[model samples]
Target chain A: MAKKTPLDPAAAFRVPSGLAELSAIDPAGTPIGPQDKESGAAALADLGPDLAALQEKLYAGATGGSEHRSVLLVLQGMDTSGKDGVVDKVLGLVNPAGLRLASFKKPTPEELAHDFLWRIEKQVPAAGLIGVFNRSQYEDVLVVRVHDLVPPAVWEPRYAAINDFEQRLTDSGVTVVKCFLHISKEVQKERLLARLDDPTKFWKYNPGDVDERGYWDDYQAAYLDALNRCSTDAAPWHVIPSDRKWYRNWAIGALLHQKLTELDPQYPPAEFDVEVEKGRVAAS
Target chain B: MAKKTPLDPAAAFRVPSGLAELSAIDPAGTPIGPQDKESGAAALADLGPDLAALQEKLYAGATGGSEHRSVLLVLQGMDTSGKDGVVDKVLGLVNPAGLRLASFKKPTPEELAHDFLWRIEKQVPAAGLIGVFNRSQYEDVLVVRVHDLVPPAVWEPRYAAINDFEQRLTDSGVTVVKCFLHISKEVQKERLLARLDDPTKFWKYNPGDVDERGYWDDYQAAYLDALNRCSTDAAPWHVIPSDRKWYRNWAIGALLHQKLTELDPQYPPAEFDVEVEKGRVAAS
Candidate 1:
């Protein structure tokens, strides 16, 4: 028998994780087990320890480092996909100074008149800051796609534009991590019903959500297309199966920590003479 | 001699913690502690544990309850006050999903045309969320007072409008915690200088801050007046001394947690049928 070779880390990295499979409109079945040979589950678990270490690195870096390369995490997910929960948990790990969030919804008439990206661009983190976008420009893709607010041809061009845009950001040193939380229709229905029954949640139970729910298949198809086209080496999409909130949080946090540590932003190179700093301090 | 009386917690809380006394416009008179203590040292310490607890409560509440009341924390402060640092630290403690941030700046021509509060209203927290405003509607007072943008008569009416707006919110169960990070002019200059001298922080340094510093006396007078008049029983203003970044974080965190815990939004009174919940799960 021929000798079986072991998997190398680089080769393993190239094999798309279950994240990609889940992101597809029609995902192929994969075997699941405690060891998680399945790409999605393993990728999700892989994020844990790296997330913890990166979190510690970020906190220390924020307080002690003069120049920190800030990161912005943008999450776009379907209603039941758990954007809020993901954000709350993942960001809990980073230092507060280094993290901020902007959640975008239906823009007013004034917002509509301006370019779609205008309001979003203003929300990006300045250098050395981390900004998270709960629903980002991809809204131009998913929401716009589902609603047909923009023609197919119009948004078709946007895929390349978005890829270029994200690449520019990556080149400029903005580590952009994007996640699309994927949940099954059955799970979504249960959540919707929960929202409807509770009075406090009645505020969140928009009649519109029901209307939107009818078009679930369309939305799923739209998301798959967006993921397939927009997913790039620069800003890869992690399609998280969020039927489990705990698993989702761990996966997202791990992905973020991995991307940030890879960037490895360093402390400011210039240092002041201690005596001079003291003298300047005294003078002030 | 008559027995000396000791201060109670409420009485002690009123004793000012020697914050203002420690703040001298001149560094020569300011006591240099391990960390910058002239302004924020005491205030931060007071609020730290409370903020930590609030973060945990926010997560616990988010997970267990089907319904949660969203909270908005507005931080309005003078230039040298630690608004950014406070946000950097206090927000550091919470689950990110529960938090959103809006940092109001010079309004665009579009923003200027609308009623000032229109933009702010859109930023308010949704049910079960928390929103933070770096600078808010009080800008109508702070900037207007200093710049004389509107006549006193017009601006004065806003105080009533502001009170009514807040009352409406409290009546609807929206709890607002507003903090004014108070720092002395002397401390402001030291931090501003630190920004100037450090290459990495140079981006944060604006010549405009110096120009504004020239008007320090005018701005301080305006804030004191606004704080006195607008600080209401419903949404009382906590004037946090912010010379020490760590202390400021703690005080602001503590104040917010105390307020949120007091609100104590619980699970809705109506119970969900276990069978129905199970059926919904089964159907999914």
Candidate 2:
């Protein structure tokens, strides 16, 4: 008999609906993974082949001109929440040809001129691709809210706007997996200090990261609103406990693997007469 | 003391100057790796960490706004010559975020309206990114020559134009690594048959591939001319013997690793005052 899989990652990591605040889930907890660090990384390694195979089927179909489905993983976290690490270890398992990655930093003058969703729309995964957005539409809600960059009237409606955008994506065969990498304030201090401690890591340090720490509570409030309002049947928010780097990597890898498995893309059947093709090749 | 290293991959794989015939090198030869299959795969695994580390430095330097250097890997070959396989196995060794891959198929009507290099130029690797062009500007010369799609006056002069284009890429802090995945005519027949026998791989089989097979000598002549003419100091062509899939993967992996190592990207120094930021982070 097959061993029972652990809890559905969908249910295990799904942010609860009607959530009141951000303090509910333990940032250090491993809700659906091995209880230790080494096993977490090992588990991620175990997922590589299956992930790659599934991705290839999808890639084959797309490149073969027969498929039009895609997946988009949206990553959101406060500064130093390990979004980049998750991408390297987790999403990195699949072929890059089938993957599209976009990182949204502060808006440039051109980006600022457009509607928030304008640039986001352009980067949505093409058919058969799996796209990742390092920081995404949620930024308009979180950062914009925390800094009062826009009045509540403007920021308040974006949750609905985001949900509608995600709904449209799903309607067009896109599966959206939005993850909020949850890290504690103490962890942020440690990560920043560690970056400062290593000369090789100094480039990762931004003084603004420390300045943003002062807005930790504000970001959490904004994130709570995002999770509660936008989490829907079409695309739900998954709060990946990111305090442990190993656990964070494992969880995101597991979630993405689970999503791709659910899609179960298949190679398109032979378009030509197989016997005729074989005869032609044999002769040539 | 360190162990003796193998012949410089740079020299071992580079196509000879003034090559007038495609038959000069055996397409099935493994000139630069372990003669056995298992060791070839094992060797690629050994290069993974160094490849990943070097990629991180380039990614960091670019993302951190301190580096302008990038590498472009242009892959050109006949159908089923293992270009896609090399990308999956060799280029796949690096971080996906730092890697940019562009697969150029036949040009669209809009693309045809512009100079051949227009589309190729737009996709050149940005600063701090390693880009792979699955099929590139060389197609203009190779296929255009074989099909007589353009007159001698037009296609013949493309060699000089390509040289000028690549030279410009080098002058702008780009290192171009051009590889021609050389597979024999017999191997293509075998590979096409293999795809026919395997149902799952049928998506990869194209009817036109057989049509192209009929033009083998014409294509080979075209290739030799393009290889000899376009092979330049700015970006020489590396003729990878690709009959053994394992060796092809290893050779390309080794060549790319060697190229990245040669670029020697550095992690940028601290852009902010470290002690001051440390104090701010600690206090917060």
Candidate 3:
């Protein structure tokens, strides 16, 4: 039997440097993968070892030498868009030691008092780690705008602020991959219903989802604005059509696999002489 | 084929509350799992789904209701005993969202200025998460004692301090599982030589490992003292036979599986009226 090669989702789904139209993307579509769940899952499992080995090399590079590079994956989406699911199925493939995961909830009083970037800056992955932001600095424009939590004057400059911050991170050797998890309004309602129907998932449902759903159009407009504006050469955004859970997970896995391969982190050369170390160990 | 039945390691290897003997334990023995490497690995892989489900229930119980419980696994072993290996094979099976991992290195100036646990207290897992400490507060008694990093006056009282701190944690809803990964001195020598022999593993070799090995007897004495003094009803130590990598990983997985099953976290009941929420979601 011939070996099955998988899609390069980093290319298939990558939004060009500066533009995105969420409405044009299909929530349930498989942009470039196996057409069904089983094949998609098999392909995902195939990527695991390669992904783990690549992530470890990146980690080894930092500890043994001057490799300072890190990757930050920013997951942005409305509630119930499966940000958490993608994290489990995709990012979970690597050694957890290689991951620096931070989930941003509503701001605490201390966080609200600082510049929005302050807390985020504190959590950027250390050298050679892959950092994932569950929700991120982009919320300053999305949620803070939609809920009228802040006046337009307060939230308006955040798009420029985010771009500047990402550019600075890139300049310092951080490669940023931003993914917008796009699910349709109808799909979101079905998901909410499923959460209500299942005892296991009830904890995931928020009562406030109804209020958010009422402003669906407004949220979409806000998201489109943020998506269209904040992307750049160093920090491009990928629109992951996330209605199908398997495809979403596999796509993110493929994307990460591609980026890490491009980074091509080498195991740091031994700092100590091999023969001397061998003698020391044998003697011990 | 009849199903394979694995041993309950929580029962098999758990050091009885309040006592331990490091010298009596065999590092290469498979205390409970299949003796062969391939069979042991199969058993560990077989455990993934159940462990993932149990962990998710704990997460759900916390999110939807009043579950405040958490589990902390403390992993301590001499160099090259495979602490990192166990973490990848075991903890990496569950949802990464459910894990909070901290690796302790030599204290920084800031850490040294405070009480030994000042840095540790900051990183405990939140409600419903599983926290893994790569090396833990026990180091106050082990490494500190071996190297004479502190006067006995400073390190002597730490055994009682750790007990008091852990007792408080148990009373406040944390379940602590401590494991001392046991590997023979000969195995450590072999492993160090292997690292020296492989280019890929050179990054893991530290020249100081030889210095530490020179004090092997002192370190074992220190480890024996800590393990003996610290076992309690709420926090017992399990001495994992870690020379065989597959068995070590499987035993830890089984130990965790048993503890989580005993915890038996229930999915929280729906907070909203299921019927009303269904109506709302359907209308949305």
Candidate 4:
């Protein structure tokens, strides 16, 4: 028996080789829109055809009715790490009816009073729907660990609790793909400064973001903990490099396209005879 | 002003004339195979370019971040009457991230305990997202009224409640398009019987649907009341003669295209232009 080699963060994860057999284009390598297009709109324009075909597949998978599979795509990342952009781009390929997007922020007083996962559970998509968590349960680890918001003992158990929660979803037939958009600390500082300089974007910035930045190393350590503990075959974590928006979108789109096509739901078998239909046609 | 006619069951209200537009083809056309030369699929194949253009328009509207306009598309009809099909076809046009779909079913214990509109509020899409309601709050007027599930005094108030709901959504800049897929009783009978006779479709049929059919006249009256009371400048009803599935798909697709174009959201004033460099663009 051969021992499997551990994954190296520096190496690109091998793209599943059989993906090309599923569709005409590789979502991962495909630069949407005109090749040299610099604008988001231009890039988005390039995405239309692949997105449309993917949406058709998604809708067919959803409405075929026999399959009970659900999917939860979780995007977790630092501020301005392209989580929103990922939702904006990758979900472009899905049927909105089949998708749910939930963005989590600081817990409200009511939310804090309950178990951490309470509000998160309500947002889960029912069978045949895809739920996207812009920020998710792992915030308990990332935020609480960095800010020391909860006493260590209270927050520590949450790492295990979340793992179990996601495991349950996967066991119940949810294709859970979690991505952490990794950006350099220098990038974060630049974005925060930009937010402050622009009045129109002032609403998006906070003095608190800088405070959080002071603990960047702490958050990364916590993230490493969560990822190592929760990466199961049923729901694996893909670390998306965020220095490039195009690459991030392509990677996430490829991941989702791969998972959905694997579900392969076809129309239910027809029961009525065409000859009977011909008879009715003749009588009519 | 012209003198108003007194209400009469036989002739007081009119089905919107827009339904006739769908009949430019046929109200009772059959489905065609993908490769068939004269098939409906062949005609719809041309929608690809139209759909791609619609995607660009949708992304443009959403990014503008304007709160001045919103749009909600509501789909309602009998079992197998093509409500799901319409959603599958038309919603495929918009960017999925900018769209939301809420499917209403039997009121949960929590929902039944409140004003009928309570559960609905949480499901309303935020501004910049197109919301589609598969079945909707109109259930109080349609189902509860048809089945006498609630007393007249209880369910009757819902008509006004529903009107107020639409008024608020519109006042807040949400354009509402409600569609009822209208198929004659004989066509419905054929569909229902098809479901009963087919093993694959057995899961979709409900014994109660047969029970409900006994009250077809009552259901029609209920839909009439709901339609007349709820249709307003803010949210008008489009009745689609749905005996022809292809026409239903096309009509609903056109209506959505029209509504979103009317919404016409533009990009919000530039808030961040951090060098606006390739992927490195940030706020500062």
Candidate 5:
């Protein structure tokens, strides 16, 4: 077997080539963005306006007579890893009109009748919108594998299917940004305990969460396999340290801001004579 | 024609019998809950722990083999009336695992192939869950009527169809709470302008919003018709004054809190003997 070369910090955060082990990356380490909490929060606030602006341009271009391109932010995390918080704090900065938030729960009987992605494909954001999948197609591999919902023969081929599905999305003008919110078992335990301690937080305290905690190693292994197999250049996965809520929010926000800035979407030019329309409106 | 009896404040916020003109309701008025913003926020915070506890009990009862009952919060509002905000601020307080958030956008070709309710029924929450519909089946009537997407004969009967559908859900263990976030035409224009002024808010600004504004009266009429026809004792429509964001969030939160409290779900007893399970665990 050929020896694998070490990846830079950026590459380290993402899945590396060959058999990548999630154990190599620290869930508590901030590989990208500010190391301190205050600075991380400040950075997130600074990027908010730019992200909002860029998202608008993308929305306008798609809605107007111009090329339509959009971004899909897929979030996957263990229980209490702040996926919901990320959606509220980071993605919430953008205009809700152009932002489509889809939270995928367990598959329904009808959804089970079809392929796993059947329900997901329907929720994809239209041209000029930002689609945020609270939990996404990746759950087919992660949760399904962890729970032994299907046989290996059923789920083993999903990696390639996911890659192909994403590639098609990319080819059709959607930018797919996947993030795995990594939190240590200790952090998760603390969060769970806090929920139990506060009466107001009781709604969030599920007994199932405690049961699932026992399968930590199994889930990590499943995630490692997924990252190694499905993290292609087209839609690579970013493993974000989520122990610190501030860093998690900042990193995801900055990552999205960078992606949108790179896309540099512009407002579409007027299809008709603007001056004439302006005059007509004024007279009316 | 007989003279319609005057309604009390609570009944007034709800649709009155007869024509039930939208023009009669004051969008700026806070018909229920705290009269002021500071008090509303405080009251919402005060109810947090109770709401959370009630929701947890509801979830636990369903999951633990007790009588299963869930709440479906259907939120409908015109552009800029803060339907998304209600989901975030009011509903976001609950645990995401037990909460299902579904945002309905423009229907795809596949969705259009079937009846409008087909797509909605799929997204209904399972037992032990609270389902929040950002936009819902009501759109079939509101937007369809406004745009003439369907003929009068097609859209006309849908009012009764919707009434029947909701009645069926009520017949099941589901408690449906429908809210229409009512805002003035002037307020919407102000919000649109604010989005345009802030670059970050550009993503939220849709030129089509202005076009839709042209059909303001038509939408109001459609909403009035839906309210008068569909507000049954099973699933009542609450017209919320949404011009104030804080009050809107508080009102919806309070409303949900009231409903769940009334349900008063109790956690189920252990299926197995506690002492035996404890002994087994200790032995293992």
Candidate 6:
């Protein structure tokens, strides 16, 4: 008999040993099914409506007062690894009315004044919405570690703090899906060159992106440390191969689709007599 | 000779006397140009690309370190009066990358621990982004006053506090555009009934919305008081008649388009020699 495939997509790319080297994973690898770009695209297209329907159920359940569950998709990626593209393609599959997107840029003075998680806690999706953090609390460790923004003693403890924080969120009905969009350095260079070649893309081509490219090895090491330290049972980190945008989008979408399906959010039973309300409305 | 039309949309519906009663403005009034729905839609369509272009300039200028301007569109409206619809239609005209949306729901326990504006302050758009607040700080006065969530002594001082807060935002690079979506009780009733009749929209129809309908008079009074007290030179409030969704959407689009045109954010010159960079990129 064929070996049973893991039902949980999280099983495939999860940093299981908590010490998986980032360099071991191929940025162009397609770890899950569909084998090729066309099939992967087809699978994603098939899952779109299912995802939308599940979102509606989650929304209905929240409003109907039967369920208070929500999901937070935390995306951490290098420049040109298709974070925004994933947002536009995958999360964009659902009703945007129920989706909240928070992109964490550099910390403002006020944000810097508080603990790193203060701003993040405030932006966590309220009970029924799917919250997408384009870049999130992980930056506290990732960027801060790379740039020496804070001393090692300050940034080091945050891994445990983040685990505790995410655990609390899970306890309070939030399922955290953290994804690291892993891209090869060569692919990033090509993407950057493409941005330079195209004028329309120039708006997105920041000189800082090129500067950050120089720190690629440092960022990868920082990311590996973060993944190992913080990937808990409650919020496991998934390192997705992102050199192929199609596979990356599909993988994330498929993972979200599986998670929502597992959640099985139901449309709540009517609190009032639906038939009576229908009758009243018809009479009115 | 024909009287010169007011080029600024703010001139028409800006709470002029501050005592201009909510009851005095017709919820169905078409105060701006187009007399019909098609014309209003056409106007909105015409303004879309202009708005997009202005947003691009604002973003480009911010990145290029030449401009630091941003706009905050604060939308306050009754339930079923179309705040989200306006967000979808009007504010959706710009690039999502440049737009940040913060929807202030019922305060979380942590949010309650701080001053009301604490969470709000964290969500304000940074330089070069348009921040849209759906049901913003005004709620401290509006819902808190109507629902008796806090003592009058607690909520009353908030009007002045809000004016001060907005003044500070304006003193910085942020331009505050506060809009009150004004719709009649009759229109609200029709909207509520429509939601009841359509199963597809049931997710949006909270039973509490019907209960809130009973508080119509109190809400209007709360809105009027808030509008009168908070409209200021830096952050004037525009009461948009929202009985017609199309007109509301168009009026807001036109207003934003006009405001952005007035700001006329310019693209900053390249920080490095463009020709040299292009040569370097080509050589690489």
Q: What does DockQ come to for candidate 5? A: 0.10
Give stretches of model 5 more than 4 Å off: A1-12, A16-21, A31-67, A74-161, A180-225, A241-254, A264-284, B1-12, B30-67, B73-116, B123-156, B181-222, B242-284
lDDT of 1 by residue, A1-284 (tens): 11111322212222253334443432112212123335545554455445544544444445445444557787877786788766655666555555667888888788788877777778887666668898998888888889999898888787888888888887876777777776877778877777755554543444456667777777877777777777777777756556666656655655565566566654343243434543544454
CA deviation > 4 Å runs, candidate 2 = A1-4, B1-6
User: What is the two-chain DockQ of model 2?
Assistant: 0.74
Single out the weakest 10-residue window by summed lDDT for candidate 5 chain B. Answer: B1-10
Q: State which candidate has the highest DockQ.
A: 3
- Residue-level lDDT of model 4, residues A1-284, one tens digit each, is 11122323212432232322211223223233223326534544445455445444444445544556777889998887888777766775555556777889889999999999999999987666778998999999889887788899988888779888988988887778888777777767676666656644554544556557767777877877777776666667766666567766765665565565556544344334534543442333
lDDT of 5 by residue, A148-184 (tens): 9999899999999999999999999999989999898
Deviation (Å) of B32 in candidate 2: 2.7
Better by lDDT, candidate 2 or 1: 2
True contacts kept of each: 0.26, 0.73, 0.79, 0.12, 0.01, 0.08
Question: How well is each residue in B20-127 modelled by candidate 5, as lDDT tens digits?
Answer: 587677888886658898998887777666776676677777765565688999999899999977875676566544677778989999999999899999888878
Model 6: chain A TM-score against the true structure:
0.96
Model 3: residues >4 Å from true position, as ranges? A1-8, A16-21, B1-6, B16-21
Q: Write the per-residue lDDT of candidate 2 for residues B1-284, one digit (tens) a residue.
A: 11223657879988898886888899989776789899998988888888888888988898775699899998988899988888888877778988889999989999999989999999999999999999999999888888998889998889999999999999998899998889899899999999999988998899899999999999899889888988898889999898899988888778878887778788898878889888898899
**Candidate 4 interface RMSD, angstroms, 1 decimal:** 7.7
- TM-score of chain A for the candidates in order shown: 0.77, 0.96, 0.95, 0.77, 0.94, 0.96
Better of 2 and 5 by lDDT: 2
By lDDT, the candidates rank as: 2, 3, 6, 5, 4, 1
lDDT of 3 by residue, B77-175 (tens): 999999899889899999999999999999999999999999889878889999999999988898899889999999999999999999989998889
Please give, for residues B177-281, the per-residue lDDT of candidate 4 as tens digits.
Answer: 888787776787788767656554544555556667777777777776677677776677766667877766765655565555445544344343434421233
TM-score of each candidate structure, all chains considered together: 0.63, 0.97, 0.96, 0.69, 0.69, 0.74
What overall lDDT goes with each candidate model? 0.62, 0.88, 0.87, 0.64, 0.78, 0.83
The predictions' CA RMSDs to the true structure, in order, are 9.1, 1.9, 2.4, 9.6, 7.9, 6.2
